[model samples]
Target: MCRRSSGYYAPTLAALALSATLGLAALSAPVAARWARTTSVAIGAGLLVLTAIPWWHGVTTKTPLREMPVHGNWALPGEYEKIGRKLGAAVEKAPVRSAGEVGALAYFCECQVVDKFSDRARLVERINDARERSWLYRLNYLMLDTDELERDRLKPDYWLDWRSGPNVGVGGWSTTGVYRGSGHFELRPDRPAHKPHPDDQGQLPSQASK
Candidate 1:
């Protein structure tokens, strides 16, 4: 929900780097148009190497790479699919609440993923409303990758623990957060789902929750 300046730095730096490289290459030759095209490719390759040099240090220092060492054909690998199936099956059979850093799992589990950017009060109200309605709910990435101060505002029935080690889950290098690694984790509901009494509560009964 919150936007930070660091997110913009990558593309900003990339554009500046490419422009400077191309500008320098253009000045060196009279054929500006031809050099611009050829030099841009070479310069871009060099920039990529220069930017990735830090990661290369990891190899020399024997630091772990931020990738799960799992083998699977899916976009996220089978481990995530398994986790999603577990969550989905549980939610389908019972009332359950879930949230995690990975958003795809909530979708796969057939539960509406709560928006992370919402105001804390509004978010909490929605979660509570869902509970009151006895609906299956999911709030992805509760205490991870978000402002830690909001942790106490709401309580989740289950937490998906995938933020740790080098991998942060299948997201790996593609994601940014306090931790990075693949998710090989488990989640269990803190309590059983209770059926909401819409008759007494004056709310519409949820067919999914039943």
Candidate 2:
């Protein structure tokens, strides 16, 4: 998705810069008005073609312009959904820092979702009364690439590889502790569970963690 922005802008910026340079070149050339006009037209045509290259590349590559599969929906294939479900169940079993920590893990798994949090005060009150579970499942909606999931199923050592880092499979992007753009993350059952800050619910990015 981020690549699309550069793909659109870089070519246009190049064209503008080239046009400005051509204008300066025309001014310095001691040609007659007719010759100058013809040169400008030729340069302008070349600039247009150059500017259109990005669009041409898109057509050739068949790149998706948008992320969403349908209007106002984020539905993914069932295989990915199953993968997410399996991951989420595993997260529930694993000792985690916070409910959202599991969600963050899932995000790295390409889930792209965070469970909605409830009122902290009320939750604390319930915890004090021992009326609710100490932790909650705050991350849901785990999604993965169906094709990749299918491919992994055929490999004998896929489960071991997944345990280390699913994103770092035998093929491309085989770097450990890195999932797409998200960094190293894993469920450590031995470590203490994470707790959310009091102001975390609505805190701004400017507010640094203690």
Assess every candidate by TM-score: 0.36, 0.30
Q: Relative to the true structure, how large is the alpha-carbon lDDT of every model?
A: 0.45, 0.37
Query: lDDT: which candidate is best?
Result: 1
Q: List the residue pairs that clash in candidate 2.
A: 97-193, 97-194
- Count backbone overlaps in model 2: 2
For model 1, the local distance difference test gives: 0.45
Tens digit of per-residue lDDT, candidate 1, span 1-210: 111223345788778886787577657666666767677777778878976785576566745543232222122433444556667666564433433334445545665333233224324444456655553443432333323436643444454433233444432222223233332443444522344211223322233356
The number of clashing residue pairs in model 1 is 13
Best by TM-score: 1
- Candidate 1: list runs displaced more than 4 Å: 1-17, 25-76, 93-96, 113-184, 191-210
